[model samples]
Target: MFRPLVAAAAVAASFVVPPAAAAPTPATPDQSASAQQVRSAVTELAEGLSLEEKVGQLFVTYLHGQAADEVHPGNQRDFGVGTPAEVIAKYRPGGVVYFNNPSYDNIDTPQQIARLSNGLQRASRVPLAVATDQETGLVTRIGAPATQFPGNMALGAGRSTRDAERAAAITASELRAMGINQNFAPDADVNSNPANPVIGVRSYSSDPALAAEFTAAQVRGYQQRWLSRDSVSATAKHFPGHGDTDEDSHTTLPVVDRTVEQWRAVDAPPFEAAIRAGIDSVMTAHIRLPRIDPSGEPATLSKPAIDLLRNDLGYDGVVITDSLAMAGVRKMHPDAEIPVLALKAGVDQLLMPVDLGLAIDSVVAAVRSGELTEKRIDQSVLRVLRMKFLRGTLGHPLVDESRVDASVGAPQNLAAAQAITDRTITVVRNESLPLKTTLKTTSALVTGWGETTTRTLAGLLGGTALPTGGTPTEAQIAEAVRAAASADLVVVLTNALSKQPTQQALLTRLLAVGKPVVAVAVQNPYDVAHTAAPNWLATYSYGAGSMAALAKVITGELKPSGRLPVAVPGPTPYPIGHGVTW
Candidate 1:
């Protein structure tokens, strides 16, 4: 069972650097203009910074408060030594990552987030590139009042780069309106393994080519100034790929035991395509590939892996580390040491360092002790400054707080999200779908893990809303069976039934009822394979827009056109890209 959808719970110009050769061959007109501008800004900014300030430019830490564990429904005005604003003022960090999670109580609304970002920029001498993970569907950190679209898998199901582009464009437009310039999104990893826990629906597809197309489209959308004058740079994440592992890096280091040839054929293409499309940054995965680096260090701390990204794939733009606080990286080194090692490993930005002050100080100390050179520090700082310059953050640091309401969650954007989501409803097994019956007289029984689906079904089909408890018991299943006896059709909505034993048993009971049943998977598409229902649907997400699309398909208002983005391996073979139309 998963959370409900639509219901409950849950730059510049300036100086020039010395040429390597006198009168070197010139770069192309259009492409070299922006590259030259970045180089000029980086050289200028780097010249004006102290050693401590230069070191700070390489680290991006979490913006959390003293009372981080407590929930403050209102604005938290405590900008002290360790606080977010205080960290910016003291360390002069190049960037700061924002989180509105339950553990931290800083952000409650878009206006509050805008205020926080604005305040941090005001405190800093160099405008920090305020960043956040705005990966629309399951990973949306920005709460309600912002338009939440279906994620990459949903977009992949739609099988349209145009939809992927439009969704990302809309996302970037809203993020820029809120003053955030960088989005850690458009996951380029191929979901090659069905058992992969972390990146199931986060990835676009199992097929490398399909994922590559969507990733490139998303990168273009995020960078497109034509979509919105206010554009947010997209980061293609978990590089060298985080889609084939069974382990989660948050808890333990994941290992991808594939040879170079295998990785090239499967996981490397999407990242290559994203780089070609000019993505702003590529975040390193904490996962290890023994075939690539026999030293056994995660990609975030592996120089070989970094070289592979830089020289092999030819991705020159900022190489960011996946949060150093994770167990994958932290288990290998202490908080103070992560900064120095990450920089030495060729990471341009040390993201979410475990200890903010210690990380900055250690990098400075590392330079002094010959552990890292000043030139190495300058290399990363230059990239960071280049990103800020390219994003126009140096020119305009603060956001207009008043525009939070009018700009984000605009009606047109939400409509586009719903339309895109509607296109991702893959009907894997539809037996005379669209009900093929008159709705008003039909006695329909709707049941699911949460109240949202039941409520939605009742509103749509005049059905009995039978909401199941999380991991239902025998009694609940019996009650559902009794209800299904008199129903013309039974609609079962599931989140992840494969993992939920009680939900699986409930499905077994529903099948025994001998009624016309339709099973809809609201989260993982694999649930369709576990149930005996002849009609199976995959919304690919539980977002409001995703559910709205599902509702339209159920009522025959819209045709089900989405295909399976990832392969669902079971007794029934539902290959990636398999779909059924109305």
Candidate 2:
């Protein structure tokens, strides 16, 4: 059983920024003085911290538990502590990142998450920045009870900055209600390569200018103060671009061989836009660009690569590294030296190191041994503290858990999510669309990448549902085809058909069934290039909002208005803005 607790009583009223001027704009003279005062206050606080505590302020770590007091053996082995509260007390990290991995189980419900957040804060002396990867498409960590907006690519297809802003604002509000102050979101990557495994739909568009526009809009949205509380900090991620790589950085290091000129044209615009919008943090990519840094190191550990962000982009905000536990940052260096190299490379915050204890000790030792100067340590610490102060984390680190349910996944937020995704249904081929007109007495079969997705869409349409796994077994494919034989319309959902041969086989067999077939690309729109389904549509996501919007479009209750954010390349190529309107 879970209990919702009142907000902690330690919140400082002086740190709250007036709601009217919460968005980061060019400071007025008075605002500048206020900012200076914040810097001075943060400096004074930093001066009082012990060396170990100051070093601890540079890391954002994670542990496996839902409740603060829950004991886990992994936590005991890793931190010599049995609970999250104990880890926070010992290390006093600057922040903690939440994940929804069932194995880790750090998040469960709105009430539970708020309670956990308050508990963690109570354990730390200074306030902690509770963060999560609530990127809100295929990458969303929190489900259902939170509004699920169609992701960046969907916004790209709709080409609406207002939608992007509204989506991000709603997401930020829910995050604050859950006691989270930072969101690693609004991925600024321009998805130039359709084959990019990690960033396909996460990116807003392939066009640099469009990606930049949406990135700036979302940054403004996330940082806009809501309900008189400080806005959540938004991070524009995978800086220096993770858009062209076909590999997943989590598994291994990816090399992007673009020349500096090409990188500027294709990758740098969105991050530049993010900086201009006053983004609170910029996350480094685990990608190697030999042309940018001849030393052959991934950007997360390369001074030259980071200098591009610091010097070239003129961004002075916090620079956070993508997870240190990733193989991309770990394959070339020993665990103990990874954080040291990252700090040396000019990163301000180390996120999710493989071993938290080792990372903290290494940085502390480096500072004491003159490998890293205390001034350098103070440089990062001041930035972290300043961010905490400006973002209202220092003022209101706790949320009234009892009121969390009222804000998170609110009815208005869900409606906005549905409205946004409603405009994102892109019709590529419509030979058999507007099912209402095509079939007077209709029987339909819904089969796709996710079992829940197929069943949910089927239930909406009152159709027979045959759910297929990611790599559909021959038996699943045969069952789908057999189920489709008696249906008036066959709706098959495809996710990256270019990679899933089994799904491609299933789609091909369904197409041959001779009934009107509607193929929907639920994950990546590029899946359309691999199939010859005469009727095709793309929802860009399989979230409940997207599925609801998709069903309305199929039933002629809504029109298809979304354009393709990226080109579909194959024997027959679709241009970047291709979409058919009925």
Candidate 3:
């Protein structure tokens, strides 16, 4: 059952004053209690916890289920528990991470998620830091009924810090309404490598300065108190930068070969800006930087690497590992040993460990054997507790589930998303633009990589929708060609054209149909470099808002104001900040 309002207030009041004459100021939405007060409260709380409970406070794990009380086979196998409530009762983890993936079905509807959050919190002795990767673009874990933005690169292309801040603010409000107090967002990695498989389009820009500015703005937006007493803790991720790697950390450890100086110049600026902006947390990257830490450990396990954030950047907040279950961190140590090493290396919270039971037991064993001191455990616990206090999680862990629906995808939030996406649509080439003018007496055929995106675009333009797969088959190309022949215009949507040769072939065939072809790169603007289509536009996302923005640009309802955040190097090379305006 949800904690009543009066009970919550009483619980909040218990932590208000220390057992001293001079009472410390209570934490507000924007500021935490005085350091002394928080430390005193944390110390008193720490003194009462058992070794296992203290170690438990250092972890934030993900369980498999939508509701906290629902039985899940995966959770049963992983935790010897069938429900999130049982897992929390048994493990007492410091926090919980939410995912919308098939394996971890933690998010469904807004009210369902709110109820789930409340259930999880009720099962916990301490307030659980409920978090999700709501980074707004490609990494958004929660989808529709929640306003979707065109992503970080779209915001980068729009080149407005105000838009970046507003986007984050909207996301924070929605996330808090659903009872999620933490968000891993505003990806600070500068997409310096066009070939970077993981961080492309997720990054703000290739320019360090621009990435820094936007990162700070997003941090401010996310941490700012949206309601009088509620705000989401914003985390700047992949610290030291994952922007230069070609490999995904989920599969293997990638190497960032920048020198200490080069890393400081290219990769460190955004993190610096994030720290300066008072970001609540910094997530370590799994990538190894040989120059900074020659010990051959990923930053998540590298003392020198983490020191850059601690000593150099002076970030004294929570430090979380990306995911111990990922191959990048797993390759170095055994499943049980990874958490111990991450803690020894200075990460406060172990996120998504491979085996929560084994990880906690290992830490407990390490403490017992004197390998890791209890003081070390308390330090991390205090940091986590301090953050929870500052973010108002301790006081108001349970949200009013009834109010969730009214805020999740509010109309004003949707409009903010559309307005941001509209500003991010970039027209790279304009040979047959303002399709409203050119196709006044003719019809258009929308054929593209994504079936839904193509159909949506077709509906918006009142054109025929010929949806094609990401890799269009020969028969699909033929069908698109036949469809193009009957239409006066062809709006070809391409996603990563360089990777999908079959889709590129479809674009070639549609262009040859002798109807004017307008190519819209829905996912990556770099798709423009691979094609010679006389007309090109880039929306950086295939989201609904992006589709609307694309249709409006084609119809001349909105002018393209977005610039290329990353360089496109091919026949017609486009530098950073290149965009065509009418």
TM-score of each: 0.91, 0.95, 0.94
Clashing pairs in 2: none
What tens-digit string does per-residue lDDT give for candidate 3 at 143-212?
Answer: 9898899899999999999999999988988898898999988799988988889988889999999999
Rank ordering of all candidates by TM-score, starting from the highest: 2, 3, 1
Candidate 1 regions exceeding 4 Å error are 1-34, 65-83, 225-229
Best by lDDT: 2
The Cα error of candidate 1 at residue 244, in Å, is 0.4
The better candidate by TM-score, 1 or 2, is: 2
The candidate 2 region of ten consecutive residues with least summed lDDT is 1-10
Superposition TM-score, candidate 2 onto the true structure: 0.95
* Worst lDDT 10-window in candidate 3: 21-30
1-582 in candidate 1: lDDT tens per residue? Answer: 211110110134232324322111111112445356556655776777889988888877676642323323322332235556656776788887877775554566777777777878777777787788989888887867888888989899999999999988888878887778989998899999888889988999999999999999998888774113377768998999999999999999999998888988999999988877767788999999899999998889899888888878876678899998899987777788777787888999989775677788888998999999999888777777766665667666778889888888899887887778888999998776786777876888888777875777666677788989568878889999999999998888887788888898888889888998888888778887786678889987876677677777877889888999888987676887788986
Tens digit per residue, CA lDDT, model 2, 111-155: 999999999988888889899999999899998798888899999
- Models sorted by lDDT, best on top: 2, 3, 1
Q: Which candidate is the best by TM-score?
A: 2
Which scores better on lDDT, 1 or 2? 2
